[model samples]
Target: MTKKGKKGPSVTAKAEDRHWHGKRVKARAAKNASRTGSKTLGPRKPGSSRAGAAQGRAAERSSGATRRPDAPELVHGRNPVLEALREGVPGTTLYYMADSDERVREAIKIAADRGIPLLECGKPELDRLTDRAVHQGLALQVKPYRYAHPDDLLQGTAPLIVALDGVTDARNLGAIVRSASAFGASGILLPERRSAGVNAGAWKTSAGTLANMPVARCTNLTRQLKAYQDAGCFVAGLDAHGGSSIANIPAADGPFVLVVGSEGKGLSRLVTDHCDLLAHIPMFGHAESLNAGVAAGIALYELARQRHT
Candidate 1:
């Protein structure tokens, strides 16, 4: 029954009806959120595969490894993304963007003409993926990162390598990488722990140097340097107070690797002992020491200068 101002139903019955209605509204909102979140990363949008989706959700909830690299991942940048699109096309080439007719647009056209999918998004979402990157408003979705061995870098080239002892800082690593790339180095080696790996900032600092440089993660540094020694690459350690001035080293005895230790501590004793030479940059001014990155640049340039002549 209805009233002018209030319903005439029993209080218990009214409460039960209100509760049921609330659940229905909540269920509809939840269903929409679930559906909207099902989009794939790049251009490939899949229809809701409910049966498999439920199983995949269950596996994720249990923290299992159903997580496959099943779909290609997105890479954002002008050069790296370009490299992936140009090199990765045979398998799958899909480029996505929000803004068209810019560099991003050009990349999109390239991908589309190459038979790759090109998807669009609103400006807000594209910015979020790149974190305000200078993507030229472009990003390419492709396969995972593939690592190569140290020897690969030395293919038909001289042996010049940089071994990062414990440089955990990404900027330092990146800056050092720029130096390494300019100096005609072959590869870079870092320990698995207490060292930095490739991330966004490092990539930016590397400035496409990463694309050319071969990097390897060693399980054990002490053992790995020995391997380089066995391969006939003389190892040199850089220190603030070291034995020899880097300039004096003649170019005739060539093909070497340089080891730079952590910023605070110049060199771990173990790593320094293994080096065939310990060289220092002569800081004439009052500054006690140089930044790990700056020192690395000087050292690398010294090596490069020696080799060029």
Candidate 2:
């Protein structure tokens, strides 16, 4: 698909999932969503300004019906609420069960320090805010997420970057971001359309990574990759089938952009064509692939290991 007058990664959906991303420097390609039934917000190139805007629009349109314009929408579970309160992201209300356990109260103590109000409510109240939401006796009502820009990550010297394409699972997206930050990646990118944007679940998945990691969203993935190229960095994609082993390539550890595709489908064709290198992790047995998060963790470690070595 074309995004903002630029061509984006293309895919045909073969029996086996293929990857869709090009290699480049710091800038990143946005994400692309498949058109099974949902709306198409548009593909995001690597360096496009519209990436984050597109993501905001998609969240509005996709969840517009369920969310209220003004009210206390809930973020369930202790961790999600705890992180938001600690980070000072902003909140409307804090809800906890009247009989909330010890851990929940401790989390509330942290929120209280920030002057965030804590409401002690009944099971019915928690039930309404969450239908089997797994509140764990704690939930928070907070404002929507705020995304950063690619240039924000590039401010530091030899900054590391990560670009995600078509990662639909919020949990995976969150875990990946948490891993990125844990390993000291400077920036993270997601497409405006199909990829997972920051939400409560994603936020929780990060285990507070959103608070620390500088994540960027874009309208077009290819354009963003091009922008990274102009900045004097290398870009690469993780593919199960590719030209070089992940351990053999040097770019995996350099100041570059690392692109990962959807959980099932690897890289899209359009993004693949634009890549400077396609690297695969060497498999020893019948195993052909790995989880998106696992792949990211291992790949990122390889890069880190290379830089240190």
Give the best candidate by lDDT. 2
Candidate closest to the true structure, highest TM-score: 2
In model 2, the runs with Cα more than 4 Å from the true position are: 1-73, 83-90
Worst 10 residues of 2 by lDDT: 33-42
lDDT of 2 at 48: 49
List lDDT for all candidates, in order: 0.58, 0.65
Please provide, for model 1 over 1-309, each residue's C-alpha lDDT reduced to its tens digit, 9 standing for 90 to 100: 111232111222221233233432333233213221221111112345685457435533332111233423345666655654554323144435555456565667678777776667655665655544455556655433355555444443246878988676666776788899887887788787877665544554565576667777767777767766555455677765454567754321355678887655566778866765666677656555566778888888988888888
- Tell me each candidate's TM-score: 0.62, 0.74
Candidate 2 TM-score over all chains jointly: 0.74
RMSD (Å) of each candidate, 1 decimal: 28.1, 11.3
**Candidate 1: where are CA atoms >4 Å away?**
1-97, 109-117, 130-136, 139-143, 153-157, 250-253
